[model samples]
Target: MNLKNYPRPFYAINQFCQPQCTELAGRSFYFDMDGGYDYELKVLTGDTCEWNIAGEEPKKAVYECLKGDDTTYMFDFDIVGAEPRQNFFFCIDLEQSLVTLVRCYIGRNPKFPLLVASEYDFGAIRVEGQPLPKKRHCLTGEMMGTTVEWHWNITMFTQHNYYSPAYYRITWPQYSSAEGSISPNFEVLAASDEISQYVKIKDKMYLYCLTEEMMERELGDSSPFRSNNMIFLQNYDRMYHVGRTFGSIMMDGKVVPCRTMFGSFGNPVRLEYNWLTAENPFTV
Candidate 1:
């Protein structure tokens, strides 16, 4: 691939969903911004020139980034995920002289945020690993006089209650099994990334500051619990081992306030994992 074409936008990004099944065929991609190049780097497209996957020995064809308008661009391509339990990593050199390669993860259902490159002027961005696909659990709230909604990855559940931990596992359901076998994606999430918060009022635990949705849909009705867009945050006493504090998501760029069940008292705090004082299992 040649390097001197395209406008120079401060940043570039490539986003895609990890494959949920096997035998998928596709290419995972990403873009670069101020990291290099002289032009504004508006976008890459088939007309400008085709993109070739750097690693494939024969240089296979990949998707093109078509300029949608003055402010946007789009690309269409299929990304294949490794067999259920595996993952893939693809990389590109941002600064040829520095020998530094920027990488992205290819796996099942990873949620990523959009970024403006200028904000990260000097810092670099990289995806450490692929995120596991979560079993979507619905949580609803109201904002701007309208009902807002989002999902929680169900961590644990029981006959009498359900649990959505601040961080947890996401499992994939097998299609061929008679009883429906499942396998874990093995990706763990943190409270900060999940935008989750917990609260204790009248000794009961309630989660607040969750992502909101604009519409609702029925997924299934066969589970032991209701599959409707609602979830039960198990009482504090039922899962005290989980933690004393709650995890909450941010709204409109601010942390949603936590309140007592009666709405009289509100507790607003940032929930984070203490890596220093807590146990050390993994070193980043």
Candidate 2:
């Protein structure tokens, strides 16, 4: 499996279980966010163990294991029924300090193993007097001892469908001042064989088409184009809209809209559009 696609770093190791093996014993895993802050631990099972820390509290199935030792243990938070794409965090309470860990897991699969361990030594621990220091990803073992950076890229997945509903008003520019506004009506006569055409609307020319799901994902959850856009040729339920600008059209390229206009739900829809040109003067 590609590790890049997954949100968290996943590693599977089948090693021999040990006696003081916190990994095999199923002890509640504790994550310390900062060097001076309080620590927290969640009991993976109902095994009771006592260790020194700071302030502790039980918050909604999560127990805070306060500040003390910087150690990592195995833990499983019952997150099987959680909603997808939601972000949340966990806090551990140690008597001397407090630690917090931010986490996000999409989809219904929730069995996660946390790897928490740190090498740095913070200042002396305090009692009920001061607030716990803020948690850091370094303690959560997310950092790999290297400078962190990120890059962004946008790629065209495919062209989905096109539609010019009756509600939408289409207009074109006139060549000269003498000619006025021109409005060309369009109606679907027949669809040609799925011939991959290299259409040049203006200057740009596209080689491939995008899948319907990719279109909606780009648009986001609440898109105005959803529902009332053009319908897919093969699947009428799937709606699509044309994405074209004067620059793109004049550059010699085809304007293939996203199929996400059909709305958000289960499966994504598919659609197609064909141009209707005039004989004498160029019109579509």
Candidate 3:
């Protein structure tokens, strides 16, 4: 997968099982969100997309699709002609007929304008005559305290710990040492405490978001691994995840887009509750 290079220091990973999607090609879908927003997504044979908003402008953009689990298709694309530049990511679950969207923005916000801001929404997928699914993906707590080491490029090995609901820790030790994983071999710096959020999709499936803005602030422009905004679906049943990233960094005195899609496997290790914090998210 010769996807474009991302910001320096973050070639997250790829799962050994997940692959670019071929199954959702030529499939069409309709989804309605909470605030009267909706979309009609048409997936072409080659993964090209021509999507339109219900009451907004339309665009034809080629999309990147990856088959994560058996029924989940992780799809996303740039909004072809929108000013300020935008990207939309969707996790379409066939079995549940559910749809979740994450709309990412460039430097468009009025406040903290340089941050890669995003908005999330979930709704039911409308099939021709089938009733819509009632169970939309919602916030989750199950992953709290669970540690998983995710495989990335050889030099990008890292582990994540959902130490609490609002904060997470990223370490560069190579493995979670779970039953089927290798023991840790090296140590990357303990990531500065960061925020992580999760949403349950199915019995063992979830959507996770991670941002490094806090760390980005500390590292300043001197750091090689700078801006990051990650959102991915974690399929525990298959031990793999597929998701997208869209954030910018100041490179050589210019802001550059560092966005991408990736899939990687994780080894989950269970730990006692006493090992993690008991406080709520973002409470300090």
Candidate 4:
């Protein structure tokens, strides 16, 4: 497969298994993030694809049908199911040159849930194509080993089994959905417990600090991040999340502070004790 033809990094490209989607439906692909999927489609079809997950925005892939001298083709897209090997069905009518959604579903993958389990509050931001805020300044990070440019991207609140009635109804009906959203305002710098540390990306330097008070409120029993009766601490100190939330960009000897929060995001997940939560969701 041509790597440039795809929008983002992908795992495998197998023969299209869905029985109905026949016109040029050559492969089934898997990607960890929506941004990757969107990037892939945009490069292939030259149209912005929109697949809506968790009611956020339609960020799914789109296909454009083509008619040639002797063949009809549908824009190639991935077929996702409850598992990698399973074949979920979708159809494309050859005569009409229009693809029909016969049957489709997205399977569960553990990578995201595992990577994001503890740091659930770390929102994913897509920075590549977006413009920064007016007063916001860019910073680079230098840990004395490597100097890296840190850019602000899109911010997304990660969660598992986020509500999508139609999506869950077909993919994995047995699993229950769990939701929570408590993020730390500031991050902690644990580089040798020094009161403050300065990291530079080229000429830009960032000063860091820490905070206290991890909420003691009880999270629902069904919280996906909770494991072994302890809630996954959504610490903002994770290097990536901290770089966006707390680090102050230094320019011309003046410190430019970042925001405690960015964009108009939904309200933080409210934590309540004895929440009578449901059982954990089983991955498809």
Model 3 TM-score, all chains together: 0.80
lDDT, candidate 2, 1-284, per-residue tens = 89657674322110111112233234443443344444444344343333223365533332222111233221213222333322222322233233333333332222311111112322222334555354321222111111111110111022222221101112112432112211110111112112111211111111111111212233322222211111111111222111110000111233222211111111232322222221212113
| lDDT (0 to 1) per candidate | 0.21, 0.23, 0.69, 0.22
The per-prediction CA RMSD against the true structure, in angstroms, equals 21.8, 23.1, 6.2, 23.5
Error of 3 at 124 (Å): 0.5
Best by TM-score: 3
Model 3 residue 157 lDDT score: 48
How close to the true structure is residue 129 of candidate 4, measured as C-alpha lDDT?
Answer: 56
lDDT of 2 at 77: 34
Q: How do the candidates rank by TM-score, highest first?
A: 3, 2, 1, 4
Q: What is the alpha-carbon lDDT of model 2 when measured against the actual structure?
A: 0.23
Question: Which has the better TM-score: candidate 1, or candidate 2?
Answer: 2
- Give the per-residue lDDT digits (tens) of candidate 1, residues 1-284: 36544454421011111111111123223332333521111123332222333333222223322221221122222123322221111112222210112121222223212110011111122323743222111222211111111111122111111123232111222321211311111122121122122222222333332211111011111111111011122223333111111112234555332111111111222222342133312222
lDDT of 3 by residue, 1-284 (tens): 45545444533344232556767777888897774789988787676877888866656888888766778877888877766678888888888888888887766546445556667888889988777777788778988756886765444445677766667765553242221131221112233467677878889888888766565555545544344678878888878788777776566877677766776767865544543443433354
Count of steric clashes across candidates, in order: 22, 44, 3, 21
Residue 87 in candidate 4, Cα distance off native in Å: 19
How would the candidate models be sorted by lDDT, starting from the highest? 3, 2, 4, 1
* Candidate 2: Cα lDDT at 194: 21
Residue 127, candidate 4: C-alpha displacement in angstroms: 20
Cα-based lDDT at residue 49, candidate 4: 39
